[model samples]
Target: MGASSSIPTDPNQRVQVIAAGYGRTGTVSTALALERLLKGPVLHGGSQLLVRDDKYCKLWLDAYKAKDAGDKKKTLKLVKEATAGFVATADVPPVDFIPELMELYPEAKVVLVRRDPEKWWKSVVALTSKATPWWLDVAMAPIPGWRYIPAFMRRFSKSFLGLAGVSDDKASPAELIERGGPFLLVAHNRRVRSVVPKRQLLEMELREGWKPLCQFLGVRVPKDPFPRANDAKAVDEHAARIFTRVLQVWVGIFSTTAVVVYTGWWLWRNKQQSLIRAWKSLKTMDVRKAFGNVWKSIRLIDLRKSFGRVWNFFKPANIKKSLGAVPKAVWPESKKPVVEHSTGYSSIWLE
Candidate 1:
């Protein structure tokens, strides 16, 4: 039995339902149904780590490390910490630690949610068909803030593939599933049955719906229909929606950044041109001549002030007469006779 030394044993807050099911075996629906029936928080696989608090991701990582190191006590402690506040835990990390969980909370009911293995495998393939590519993993490795996505992908790949004793990095999904599916499903079901007593174990299919689950958990049947969730189509739609929204956001960010950067560069270039023009104009300016003109204006002002009376005495009756102005031109009597050019066109061209 695994030791739970680090976890404070709480009889009152112990997990009441542990859904020991493989992924894509209607585990999501089981989780939702259990939550509604049990009327308490239920931790579903990847829900806590991916959708909920990212802090739980690190906890799972630690638990995975502990499991790999064969430290059952540490693994149990990490599982307890990860699922501390939940009343029920199902799927993934929890499913992997079922034996330890049964030892910790013997009173907790274990529900083995099963489906047709082939159909389950199909659903799994549909859901994970878009698994992050190896190139994407490497590309995202060096990115600062985007490490979580690749980290989650890596951890998820490890947990799911590792459970089936397949290396995701080495094998394609089809190959992994074909080779390991039967053994994985059989082993997991056998292990759960062997560990939990018949009285405390409930084997169920989603098609069986709420009656069995309700009876097992001792909860009144809900008036509403049993939740048939995480269908392959629904999963695909949800993934597409999320992808579209993320793409739109990234496009918007890239566009806004491009506009801002281009505007700043254009403004800087214009300012640079203006500065260059000003410098060139300044360089061409005759500084000595400009200073001379200024000095000459100042001297004229001084002269006007020193000889105000003499200047007025020498002034002519009319300034125009003193400057010898010419009279305006007068027209001759006959329009000065039109002149003809050698080129067969009048000197005075007409429209």
Candidate 2:
């Protein structure tokens, strides 16, 4: 079944369904079913971030970080930010935050999609084996415009592998899943059961078909068969589509930025060359002569000022001395005279 046209655009709109199911547990099918039943968008894995207008990959990454930090409030906020405008969320990253999401949207019905544990693990191994390799993801990371590919891989590893306690140590998917798969399945199911009330939760397997799901959601089952998604070929095709879309977006942005930067630099260089040419032309025209004339005018003005000062000093009342002679007004007057002799020398004193 196709998604409904009635999906609301409001990011803050209350969510109607929360698929608190691990990946490989018929999540894609459940998401499709929920979208058809709810008549709104159902987010599933990276597909929503890739296909939809909402770019919640970064927000999901942030939510993972918040989860690691054990900050429930921060995790809730980030989950809400990522899942906003969507009526339902199914699959890995969303499933990892089920507890916080349950608390945040208490009114939302929880669908715990289930499958035989061994079969689920087998599916997980198969899918992860086909995933982009760790080395390839790392190698492509430093390349400009390809960083998103590695980023998506890392987010997947953290949300899926890390949560399952599978080491991202370059091990084969079979080995990693063998080590972590059983425990992850048991612990995850146990946690979900412990948290969600029986009335609010519907445990389902895709093989059980649409009736159980439709009844749980109080909606009519579609005439179409239940969605059986994430087959190997379908998974590969979806991955290709996501990669193509992401690559196109990054390439377009990179091309646009390059054009803008080159245009700006070309315009600036042309303006700079024009200024240099204008300066060289002024040099050829002997603009220094004009500067020299101005300097001469300034010096003449300074010399005129010096002459005026000299004339002022020489005016009658302003003159204080003539040659080396002292002025009589400045000399001391004698009231008595005395003579002294010392070492056959005589001196006269006036007081």
C-alpha TM-score for every candidate: 0.65, 0.61
Backbone clash numbers for all candidates listed: 0, 0
User: Cα deviation in Å at residue 277, candidate 2?
Assistant: 25
Tens-digit lDDT track for model 1 on 1-351?
Answer: 011112223435668899998777777778778878876677776455445345656677788778778899998898887777678887676887888888778799999987677666666655555545455454433333333555655555555656566655444444554564545666668778988999999998889888998898888999989987744554566456545655676677779999999999999999999999999999999989999999999887767666976776567754545455433343457565433333334344222
The C-alpha stretches of model 1 lying farther than 4 A from their native spots are 1-12, 71-74, 131-150, 164-182, 285-351
**Candidate lDDT values, in order:** 0.68, 0.69
> Which residues of candidate 2, in runs, are more than 4 Å off?
1-8, 52-55, 138-152, 155-175, 242-351
